[model samples]
Structures are given as structure tokens and as C-alpha cells.
Target: MASIPPAMAPSTANWHWKNKNVTTWAKTWFERELPTISVQDDGNEVSVSEVVDVDGDVELGQRKSKYVPPMY
Candidate 1:
């Protein structure tokens, strides 16, 4: 009788979601949409907000953004 080899784990290096590779599309969309995003504070008169910091783990789908209101 012949012995079968153990199965290998599936590769997720190029996967974005369930069996689909949407990295390119998602990345492009995120880049385009990022510039249009704005964070505003309702308590104060925040006329404009500038992106002070941006950091996150893309693979984990985690993102953080810090906005600073301009000073007169």
C-alpha cells in the first residue's frame, strides 16, 4: 500500500477576502477615498482638519488617523 503525504496549508499571501484576490482594487479604492475623508469635532467650530498622523496594519485591516484643527 502507498502512503499519502500530508496536506499543505493554503496560501493567503495574495488573498484579500474569501477565496478572492481583491487587493489591487481595494488598495486603489482606499487611496482614492482616503483623501476625501474628513474627521470633524462637533463640539467646537472645526472649519478644517488636517491629517497629522496615519498608521496601521494593512494586512489586519486596521487603520488609524489623527486630525488637527488649524490654529488662528
Candidate 2:
């Protein structure tokens, strides 16, 4: 469905990804919230400083079409 000149389109056949230090979106939250997530003694011991529970609600509905077909 796209109409464009071939010369203007960027070629991805020879594209090479570069290694860069990209920051993660959840890195800050993990460090601040789950700093105590670790194991000890051959992964036999575990600890958690805090725990959080989330709750939510959702509603569903249907509406009739506003358009009416013209009477022939």
C-alpha cells in the first residue's frame, strides 16, 4: 500500500547493529524496588524486603450503530 521511489528507500540488507550502552527502562525500578533480590549458600537461601499487590477493575459495553440505511 506504499508508493515510493526505490532510490529514496533505505536499504537494510547490509545494515550492521552497533554495540552501545543502552539504559533499560526497568533498571532504575529494579534497583530501587528489588535491591534485596538475591540468593545465598548455593542458592538455598532467599530473602525479600518487601512485597506489593496490585488490584484493578474493567467494564465492558456495546453501542448500537448511529447510521441507518437509506430507504430505497
Candidate 3:
């Protein structure tokens, strides 16, 4: 009797779109596009309307940005 081959493990490897990691590209795009899309909040009260700071590791695919709302 012929032995059946071991079933292939299911993974993203077969997924065509998953082959390419877009995280780096996406992060770059955001950095480039953020300024163009950002709007200034010129209101009477102080508010956080823009990205004050961005800190993260591109290699680790980690990012951190903070935006604090106006206290009412």
C-alpha cells in the first residue's frame, strides 16, 4: 500500500499578498503623507491637532505616537 504524504502545514507562505512585507513601505508612506493630510487647529482653546512626536523602531516594525486631547 502506498503511504500518503504528510499534509503541508497551513501558512501565509502560500498567500500571494503575504509574500511581501509592506510594513516598511506603509511606514514610509505615512511619514510622507502625514504632513500633507494634517490640519492645523486654530481655535480659541489649546488642542492637539498635529503629530507632535513619533518614536519607534522601523526594523522591529514598532511605532509610537501620542496625541492628547484638550482638557475640558
Top-lDDT structure, candidate number: 3
What stretches of model 3 exceed 4 Å from their correct place?
1-17, 39-72
Colliding residue pairs in candidate 3: none
CA lDDT scores, all candidates in order: 0.38, 0.36, 0.39
- Worst 10-residue lDDT window for candidate 2 reads 58-67
lDDT of 3 by residue, 1-72 (tens): 223223234454443222223445445555555655534476544433454555553321111222222233
lDDT of 1 by residue, 29-63 (tens): 55555566556686644332343444442222211
TM-score of each: 0.33, 0.21, 0.30
* lDDT score for residue 63 of model 2: 21
Residue runs of model 1 more than 4 Å from their true location after superposition: 1-18, 42-72
TM-score order, best first, reads 1, 3, 2
Quality of model 1 by C-alpha lDDT: 0.38
